[model samples]
Target: MTPLAIPAHERHGIRVFAAALSPEEMQRDKAGLVAALFGDPDLDPAHVELFDTADLAGVGLAGYLAEGLGVSDAALAPDRARLEAVRGPVLILHSRALHGRAVTLIPDPRLTLLAGYTEERPPVHFEPLPSDAAKGSLTAPGPSAPAPRLPRRALALGAALLLAGLAALVLAWR
Candidate 1:
């Protein structure tokens, strides 16, 4: 098993690894997943190193994929014991359809599972707080300022415009 390494310089920030039971979930919503994890656009990318479990197997982490789960092409399985060798916390983004099964498949105490996907902007502040023991005095990256929200007046104006457009359509239909 090729150990997942975080260079000495990168150790100060949280180490993030992404595993998926379904490859399509990661393939389709990777950016959204990252955004969901680190909502602050200004958060340094180096603070979190995102790696796909599928790609890990290519790099010689054998048996990285789950086996005997009766599912085809399942993502890295903590059941294999190789995951224990990982240095930090792992975040598993799995299909909503397998929410129940994911619980049973991944039993590593270090792994966190997030089920479901949405194309719309995801809720922010999704990262789990790392324990001091796990991080070893390393300073976790601070979250940047939240995205500025539209003022009430701007929102009201947009709503009014939408309502007017709808009313016009209704009148034209008559």
Candidate 2:
């Protein structure tokens, strides 16, 4: 397995390996955002354990994270409740491969299910309806400046004056 190496500065001192595993195979049974986070050596291992989407939804991100982060059960009740209230998909690893040795694996999906963790965005992809705005929509908070324009009255007046001047010159030349 080709290990994705993070820079030393990026990860303090621990050796963190993020295995960008495909659906066919995973190096350490880690996938998605969990694998991405686990790739950092500084993160607590017990907290970074496998969490498929169902497991996350069932436990609530607060409860799931509380346990993973080694916090008390009651500590994350609010977080869990918030996740339960939302209908949208939560960030989680889709599936985790069986663990082997120390390296952790994460899946490379058909499209990115998570963002905002990094400065860069995932590559663009095409999606059908309930259309994904990020992929195709041109709508944006209007541009920093308005579109340039020439007033219709001004343009018409300028053209008329130029034509009048040309006509005068032609008459004088004659």
Candidate 3:
């Protein structure tokens, strides 16, 4: 499967976590993948999360990855292509690793696969984003409507004049 993408704006908030399990490993231990994630010292225990891609079976995997994981289309497209070429269950690993720390997305060129594997893993890495990299820009503000005009002062003055004229008429009649 394709690796998850950390947005430019959220680069500091998340880490790119990717792992692949052979069909044998999956069959041997349902928690093997979880163990691998927890076993790593560099990965923060609190930030690590695993999602079974098998859960997304028959559903639009691309859309789910985009919406749920906030994966960019750039990453999702390649992953979708790879998944289409394979069969069987795929598990998705998502880990923040460190809170508010930027991790760079470096594509791993080597595809790691175990014996009798039903799925393939693309090269992926989560490293610190370079300081010189351009940061993502915030969304631009939309056009604002002009404020409505209200004649509050004129209305108040008219009401006061009417009240004074009535009071004068009443005194004259008296």
Candidate 4:
């Protein structure tokens, strides 16, 4: 399904038209026609609005639209009245069904299926940590205080001897 990002004013108008379309009448071009009537610039064969009235328990339909369109739910809230005007390819999600309701008039033939909601993953780097700071911090634990004046060769030999002693101890313990 194509995802349409409608602006606030437009979404309200579309919602009104969609609510009236129902499930039977809104098939294919019909949906496009309704959208076009509502002045939808992107209302073409490829781009169309899918009226989702699914399991909106935690988040309401407006919220879902907001999340889907990447906008605030308040923007879509005022358009409910307009949304109730159109009957088109509408999918009532979840176990809830709209029956005989005035807003639920017109069977949208385009309303074929009502799929479950799928949460969208935000952008991969939408909230990336400050890279410069992260990189600086990663390398910030500086050279470990210069090892208190131990010579490089002496340190190496000491490490080797320590390792040998540890190996011997392990062997002895075993």
Candidate 3 collision pairs: 104-127, 108-123
The TM-score, computed over Cα atoms with residue i paired to residue i, of candidate 4 is 0.29
lDDT of 1 at 38: 33
What is each predicted model's overall lDDT from 0 to 1?
0.39, 0.41, 0.47, 0.42
lDDT head-to-head 1 vs 4, winner: 4
Worst 10 residues of 2 by lDDT: 111-120
| Candidates ranked, most accurate by TM-score first | 3, 4, 1, 2
TM-score of each: 0.24, 0.23, 0.34, 0.29
After best superposition, candidate 1 residue 141: deviation in angstroms? 48
Runs of candidate 4 exceeding 4 Å displacement: 1-17, 29-42, 52-58, 73-174
Model 2, 21-107: lDDT tens per residue? Answer: 343443344334453543543333343333234445556545544454333445434444544443423333211122222333332
Off by over 4 Å in 3: 1-39, 86-95, 100-174
Q: After superposition, how far is residue 86 of candidate 3 from its true place, in Å?
A: 4.6
**Location of the lowest summed lDDT over 10 successive residues in candidate 3:** 111-120
The number of the candidate with the highest lDDT is 3
Writing each residue's lDDT as its tens digit, candidate 3 over 1-174 gives: 334344332432323233454555555533444445334334444444434456666655555556655656665565666544444444343434434444433323222321111122345997766775545666889999999876999889999999999999999999
Q: Mind giving the per-residue lDDT tens digits that candidate 1 earns over 1-174?
A: 123222232211222243432445445454454444433233333223345544464432223222311222233332335454443323532223221221222222333533211122224786656765555466779999999999999999999999999999999999
